[model samples]
Target: MLVGEHMTSPVITVEPHATVSQARKLMQDHDIRHLPVIEHARLIGIVARSDLNWPSAAKVPPDAMPVAEVMSGNVIAVTPRTTIENAASLMLANKIGALPVVDEEEHVVGILTAADILSVFLEVMGVGSGARRIEIRLPDRPGALAPAVQCIGSLGVNIVSVVSAREQDGWRSLVLRLATDDLEPVLTALADLGVEVVSTGEGDD
Candidate 1:
């Protein structure tokens, strides 16, 4: 998945000259934690809720303080076309909560956050609320997964997700999330193919 496909668009913004109190109101009204600061239609900085609680900042009422004083000017932003995984890595590396999605001319178009990444993670893991999960142990050979998948496919089971990872020695761990509740046919088919069924059960919500 790409950042553009999941990032929040038409982002709420605050001008650098805007008062900290105004920025706080925007965050409160929109229920957002991050505010990208714009200057002359260009993104110049970003501020988070925590940025408002500085000890020195408390001396001046927020209404009298310019947002630029507390906002971080070293803004780290991403593009819409950036891969979801890459965007996530960027967040981890920066130790920041959000990234502004920018256009070719550096125009802020959207924003992505760790919360959005969590939603993507749940979808990728096939936490389909009521789906069933099946784990199979297969060899790392190229054709190993094909036969097991073919077995489940032949039984008309809708595979919601198919992810594999290398295990000890030559083993490959296959996690299959299915749309069906019944696992008898799929289990039997895999058994017929001599595939080792590691585990099977209803998915946790």
Candidate 2:
């Protein structure tokens, strides 16, 4: 759940003095969208693919443009110890897809991206055909999970995901995503079976 666990390390970087053409080539060769700008081992800023594109009809020379000219100096970053939730929040707040992981000295160590978070979340939530996602809270007990799942199975609901976590003593909150459209009936059935259905919602339709 930590940023370090999902961050991409050994990140490719472009020097501030590097020409825009050079940066573009690097991005193309690597098939990446963003590049962290560095100078003398210090994180300076970031340059995106959109920053490099110029109208083909323009007569400006590529050498006249440098990464420092168009790079976004207001780069948002996170520390290695930061949690995935916090990192994702920062990205969401800043409206950015990627976040550079920096050390105490602002030296780039890695990159955390939306793709990474989505991948991990999907794995934790389980991904498959008819994959459904639901969120609820359940009581902690030895046979809590089996009966809860059985209730759904009885309703013909295919459970594609089931994530449970213990928070605030004895009561456990669960986020269940199932691969079915008829969630209301299943939820009512769960409630009827004495399973607390705190909240329910549908998945990617």
Candidate 3:
């Protein structure tokens, strides 16, 4: 899915001149960890809760300092059209948990976070609540799926998800997720139809 579909829009931001205390309050009130820093309606930096923690030997209270002093000026951003996978890669490469979503003029529109990507991915994979998943190969011709799904339906098995991709031997491997913990019945039904079961496994929450 695209960033815009899942990004938190109308992001809560902090002004450059805003005190660190104010930033902290915003984070606490919103239950957010990252805060985009804006100056004159332009994104200037980003601040994280970890970035403002002060040591005991520090001369100044972190909260008393201007947010601009501790915020990271070299912020990374992604456009709303970016894909969730691509956004996740950027977060990994930058060693950050969140990225500011900016428009053509560099104005912040929304924010995407690692948590958001994780939630979205788990929902798509049908594994958010700890369902068992399996991957199997099927013939790449018409009528291949009709019989397999029909067999699954016969058992009242819920097909949580299915992803197919090209494979060797003119077959497609479909990764399927199910709400039921027991997989034997579904496996047996597919086997009865001469379906090749590649792999089966359980998933953790």
Worst window of 10 by summed lDDT in candidate 3: 196-205
What lDDT, from 0 to 1, does candidate 3 have? 0.89
Local accuracy of candidate 2 as per-residue lDDT tens digits, 56-165: 88576677777898899989888899999998899888888889889999999998888999987877777654565667777777887888898888777777778884
Give the runs in model 2 whose Cα sits over 4 Å from its true position.
55-59, 128-192, 196-205
For TM-score, the strongest prediction is 1
The C-alpha lDDT values of all candidates are 0.88, 0.83, 0.89
Task: Give me the overall lDDT of model 2.
Answer: 0.83
Global lDDT of model 1: 0.88
Which candidate gets the maximum lDDT versus the true structure? 3
Cα lDDT tens digits, model 3, 80-175, are 999999999999988999999999898999999999998897788787756678888888889888898888888998888887846778799988
Worst 10 residues of 2 by lDDT: 196-205
TM-score for each predicted model, relative to the true structure: 0.90, 0.68, 0.76
Point out the higher-scoring one by lDDT: 1 or 3.
3
Instruction: Provide the lDDT at 86 for model 3.
Output: 95
lDDT of 3 at 151: 89
Model 1's C-alpha root-mean-square deviation from the true structure amounts to 2.1
User: What's model 1's TM-score?
Assistant: 0.90
* Candidate 3 or 1, higher TM-score: 1
